[model samples]
Each structure stands twice: as structure tokens, then as C-alpha cells.
Target: MKTIKIIFVITFALAGLTLSCESISNPDPINAIDSTQTATIQGTAYANMDETNDTTFSTKENYERAPQGTNVKVVLNSRDFASNIEPGVDYKSLTYETTVNSSGDYSIEVPALGDPIDAEIYFDSFKTSQTQVDSTEEQRNYSPQQFPYTVRISAGLSTFNDAIYNSN
Candidate 1:
């Protein structure tokens, strides 16, 4: 009976690892067979885009007047978030970070990587929230929740980022 129990546990553990390893699937290529690619990423960052009847100015106007307002910083990673490639020395620093325009429109051109690879942009709201105490391994002392804007952008066949962000 003990032998059977041990065998079952080992089988289950192997199965779990197998499933986890296959969790990340390679997505379709962003561009065709091009030696290089240049694309523009344009989108809006706001608590909400759904315009209510209370606003007098145009939809563009309201977004500019938002208390959260502008200066929202977002980072663009060279590789997909799920890729096994290590960040190495220059990771986040090498990433392309940009600020949204006053009207909430963020337009930036993706640098030429000289190869076909997945590009991803991570936005964490406008401001950075701090933690109460520093205790983590990196000593970040910051709450991931503070960065409420969790949007993953996968480029399409076209050059435009295609208005992916649509939430508070």
C-alpha cells in the first residue's frame, strides 16, 4: 500500500510539472518575414473612457481634464512577457518608456529590432504606489496593486497598436 501511494505522488508531481512547462504557447508573429519592423503604438490611458452626460467638453477634452490627468509612464519590453529569455543586465532600463499626451493619446514608434520578435507594452496606471515597509528580496517596498493599469499589448499585423486599453 505504501509503495502504491508513493508511485501515485510521483506520477502526479511529474504531470503537474509537464502541464506548467507547456503553459506558455508561442503566439503568432507580429510581422511578416521582414528583416526589420517599425510600428507605431497609440492608445489612451484613463480611469474610464465611457463618457457620461455630466461632461460638457468633448470626449477628448474630458480626458485631458482628468484628475489622474497626464504624465502616465508606460514601459515597452523587447520580448513577450512569457518568453524564457532572461532580462540580463539591461532589462527595464533598455525598455522603451514613454508618457501619454495631454489628451490621453500615447504615440511612440517601436525601435527597429532588426529581427522578428514579439513586442509588449506594460502600463501601470499614472502614479507609482509605495508599500508600508520594505521586506521583499528586491526591497521594492511597493504594492503591485498600486499599478492598477495592467494591460498587455501584442502587436497586430498592422503598424498601429490598435486601442487596446479600455478600462478604469
Candidate 2:
């Protein structure tokens, strides 16, 4: 019986030691494709050419003067310029991140790897609700019209300088 008790104590001690020695990892690393090169596109918002409204002004004025206003967004997808891009060959993956700048310029970042990055940008417009206006009185004055915008970026070369060099 004493021998059995000794063995039991030894087993319990070994189990405790093993449990205490276990290692744990904290702060998991973010897993995302590194975009070594970045491409940036900038533009100003304006009323659509077909629209008869002359409420074209800075987002500040538009938001303050009209009941409806528009917001800009940058969009990126797995597409190739001129030709269809194969999912795995021309483009590996896709991720969408959006940012609203204090200067009213909407920015988005996407991951793409290929010769030309094919993408589009859409402008979203909406009419402010009465409740919204009461809450954000300053931004509720714009007209109620929205237009869509599209942007296409060349791949590999991320900057205007690179584009110029390639053309030459």
C-alpha cells in the first residue's frame, strides 16, 4: 500500500510539473499580404454632368446647404485591365479598407499583385432624414442627388512616375 501511495504521489507531481511547464503564445500576429508598393488615387467630388443641380461645392458646403449629400468610396477587386484576370494567376487575393479624410476625400486600400490592378470607385449618395438633419444640422443642407464614379489603376507600377517611365 505504501509503494502504491508513493507511485501515486510521483504521478501527481509529474502531471503538475508538465502542466506548469506548458508554454502559451499571446498577441497573435496579424496575417495579411504585405503591400510593399502602394498606389494612391485622388479626386474631387462634383455633381454628375447630367444633374441639373449647381450645388457643387466642398463636402462641407454640400452637407450644410442641401438635404441630400454624397460620400466617396474607393473600391478594389480582383480584375485585370483590358482582359479578365484569372483568380489565382493574375490576382491572388483581395481585401477592402476604407477611410474618410478630413478633407472630404475618401480613401481605400486594397492588396493586389499583378501587372495592372483593375478596380472601380463608386460614389454613394443619400438623402438625409429629418432626424439625421436635426442631429447633424450643419450637414443636412445638400441636394438629394447621388452619382457613381469609377477608377482604374495600373498594376505593378504604383505611382505616376512609374507609369510615366513605363510609357516611355
Please report the candidate that would top lDDT against the real structure.
Answer: 1
lDDT of 2 at 142: 32
Clashing pairs in 2: 63-139, 65-141, 65-142, 66-141, 66-142, 67-141, 67-142, 116-155, 117-155
Give the Å shift of residue 21 in candidate 1: 44
Predicted candidate 1 versus true structure: per-residue lDDT over 51-135, tens digit per residue:
3332555444443221233433444454433235543523342255566556545666554443344445555433332222232
Residue range with the least summed lDDT across 10 consecutive positions in model 2: 159-168
Cα deviation of 168, candidate 2, in Å: 45
TM-score of each: 0.35, 0.37
Please provide, for model 2 over 6-124, each residue's C-alpha lDDT reduced to its tens digit, 9 standing for 90 to 100: 99999999999999999976743434444664566554433222222326553433332221224434456534322443344544324454433444444444554555565555544
* True-structure lDDT of candidate 2: 0.42
Compared to the true structure, candidate 1 yields what TM-score?
Answer: 0.35
lDDT of each: 0.43, 0.42
| Candidate 2 Cα outliers beyond 4 Å, as residue runs | 1-34, 47-71, 79-95, 128-148, 155-168
